[model samples]
Every structure is written in C-alpha cells, then in structure tokens.
Target: MASVGITPLSAIDWGAPWLEPWRVLGEPLAQRVTATAEPVHAVLQSAVGARLPVGFAPQSELPAGTAYEQHIWDTGRVPTRDNLHDFFNGLVWSQFPQTKRRLNQLQAQALATQGVRAARGPLRDALTVFDENGALLSAPAPLWHALRARDWQRLFVTLRPLWAQAHLILFGHALLEKLVYPRKPMVAHVLQAQNAINKIATWEGWLCAAMEADAWADKPFAPLPVLGVPGWWPANADPGFYADAQVFRPLRATQADARR
Candidate 1:
C-alpha cells in the first residue's frame, strides 16, 4: 500500500546513518508533516481494517466459527504509541545500543516526508472511526487517557521515557506508535533562525531512530518472524523495503488511491 519510493528513506534500516543530507533536507519536510492534517488522515483511514492480516495484534481470539471477525480485527488494529512501545521494549531496547541514532533518523524522515495536509476533519475523523471499529487494544491507561484528551505536555513527559528506552531497543525499522505526541516544539526556538534550525534537526535525529521502522509501510509490513534468542532479530527486508511511497505519491493524480 505504501507504493514504492513514496515511502520515506528513513523508513528503511540501512545499517547506519547513510543519508545525512536527506536528514538535513528532512527538517522542513517533518514540519510540513505536522503543518497539515489530510495526508496523515488519509494514511490512518486507509490503514483501518488492514492492520491485522499484516500481523498487528496477536491473533484475535474470536470464537472458532467467527474467523471472519478475527480477520477483520487483526487487520484493523492500527499501530498505536502504546502497542509500538511494547514491541520495541519487548525485543530490542536494552540490547540495541545504536537505537537512539536510528530513532532520530526516523523522526527526521517522518517530518521531512515534506508532505502536508490540504484540509481538516478527515484526519481526526478517520482516527476516531478506526478506534470505534477495533476492539480497544489495551494501552497504558494513564497514557491513553492523556492522549485522548489531547494533553500534549503531559503526553510528552509520559511518552518521553517510552521513546528513550524504545530507541535503545528497536532499530529505526518501524513506525511503532505515534498516537500521542508532543504538540508544541520541545525546546524554545532561539531568535536566530539557524539556531532554531539546529534544534529541529537535533530533534529529528532522535525521532527518526525511534518511530520509523517501516513507519513507511502501509500496514505493519510483513509480520516479523518471532525471534527466540534474546534480543535476536531475524534478517530484515533489504534496504528499500518501503521506499515505494515516495515515487508512488508523486505519480498519483490525486489522493483517491492513496488510502491504505
């Protein structure tokens, strides 16, 4: 669903910090990802009902006769910040030392998709509908409530530790959960534009590393095979795993086909 090339480069795990310039170019791109709502909305909507087949939630435990409902729920469980943190912390955090750099790269890439929204309601509505459709995937009650209320500062303080440890665990291979996030800028912007730019770039570095493993994927990409050995990960999809979105978005005439 991500349509090749249209997927941001940072979405892929290319071993290390290879795209430094792209990360540099990524600053405004990330700002634009936040500036508008439509693109994000489209992504959220299209993704609904598609999350499970891709192995999002643990196999939905519907009655044996209701495999269809099970199919729907599994596919529909869109990744959230809580679920995401669980995935990373469960597997990679303490072990992956380079996770910080990886997450910074992801944030930069997500922000720098340099894409934007042209309208409103669609974004918020899609998310609401998705929540309504799926059985609520359990989340940390405190964090979920804060996010639901749109409490930005509290959400930031609460999620910061999640992201911090997550960066250490998950390599920047997936966009685990971004349900609740910081609203205002994390730091004061200095009067100097260059200083402001530097601050944002720094933030991007941390962001990309934590939230971007296949953050580019339309659904949760291919389900990762379970790794039995502690902190062990099976081989990943090669470089260019979800890069299609970049090329795909540009070639499309409109947003009609862009939904998940």
Candidate 2:
C-alpha cells in the first residue's frame, strides 16, 4: 500500500471540542483536507486511494446483501470528509480500511443470523454500535482481555506501559455524539498489538504501528468505550473520578508519568 502524508493535528482548530478525535490522524492529512476548498469526496478519495488503490463507489451500485465494509469499499458511500462526522469516518477509512471492512463483515454476519430484534445479543449490539461509530483499539492481548473484563486497574494502572501500545481509531458517529455528552462504559475494538515501538505521527502512521503488531489479525475484537478511560476525557476533572479505585484505580505517585 502507498503511504499518504499524515501530519500532526496540534495547530488545527476543528471548531467543536468533540471533533478533537480527528487529531488522532495527526496534522498533515487533517490540515490539508480542512484547508482545501474542493469537494471533500474528491479529496478523501484521492487521499485514501493514494495509499490503497481501491476506491469507494455509490452504495446504490452495490449488490443486495453486501457486507457493510465491502459496501463501503465497493461503493465509497461513507460520510464525506467535508463535515465533522463524515470527516472522521473518511479518516478512519484512510487509516484502518481493512479493519473497517472486517467490522462490516461481522456486523452483516450478526444481522444475518440474529436478524433485527428489540433486544440483540451483546455481540450483535456491540457490532452495530461499532459499525456505526466505534473506535478500533489495538493493544497487547492482556490489555485487550483486561478491557473486555472491565478490569480498570489492569487496563489503566497495573498495565500502564501497555497503553503506549494501545492505539485508538475512532469511526463511530454515535461514539462521537456520546463524547459530546460524555458517559461511561465506552466500548471499542480490542485489537492485539503487532509492534510496540512504532511511532504515531499521522493516522496512517498509527495504522502502520497497529498493523505491524497485527497480533489480533482476523479475530473479532470485543467492544468497550475507551472514552471512559481515567485520563482520556476532560470530564474526569473531579478528583472523585479517579477516586473510584474499582473502575478508575489510582496509580502510585511514582508510577504516574504525566502523558495525556
């Protein structure tokens, strides 16, 4: 796959605070897209296609019963990069298109077997949420298991170093909406890491780092909203937020290294 230049997102003001997730893509691509005055579909297609030759087509063109991700690739009908929601979706496609495709496949499978009901299985519900607005999280397997079990201590404190290995790829519109309100029990894809030392400068770079770690390749990642992470959101401004050792355990004074 070719490499698209992904820049840092430090200087750009994405207008709304919730749109902050775009920073994960770094600056290059984000800044370029925001600065460009052309149609976003063209810009996103050019950027995504520059790296992966496959382009998106209209959803109407796709065959009936096509998997979600395949439809996205086959019909590029994702949110355009022009607005906030679509922009993030477009960025996700550029960074983690394969994983996105896999998510679509799983969502389709779940729908096929279970169909739509008022109450869906945990896995199916999780798949739907992620399909719409979930983040792809790649980390160590232990970390993934810890997240799956909601073992906050292990995930945020004991296994802190593993966090550097943890990568988040935001794709969910609902996830972003939830972020605006900010809530608990945020679920994400628990991807196992393939590399720990790779640097995250751009969305593509972050994707490369996670792909290099590909430890959880082809496996269905479980879900958890990582936004509830202790230091991840500003809502944790309350000292009491971290005081809940059960969910947000406190790190040792010496163990606490400032890095958010």
Error of 1 at 241 (Å): 29
Q: How high is the lDDT of residue 245 in model 1?
A: 32
> Which ranges of candidate 1 are over 4 A from the true structure?
1-11, 14-138, 162-260
Candidate 2 segments exceeding 4 Å error: 1-37, 53-82, 104-126, 136-146, 153-225, 228-231, 234-239, 243-260
Against the unseen true structure, what C-alpha lDDT does each candidate score?
0.28, 0.52
TM-score, one value per model = 0.18, 0.52
How many clashes does each candidate structure show, in the order listed? 47, 21
lDDT of 2 by residue, 1-260 (tens): 01243322223354444355555453456566556544445666766666643454433445566544445544546524344444455666665666555555555555677775668566656556655655555577888767656566566667766766665645565565345445555555544334452332444445443432123233345555465554577665444453455444344455344211
Worst 10 residues of 2 by lDDT: 1-10
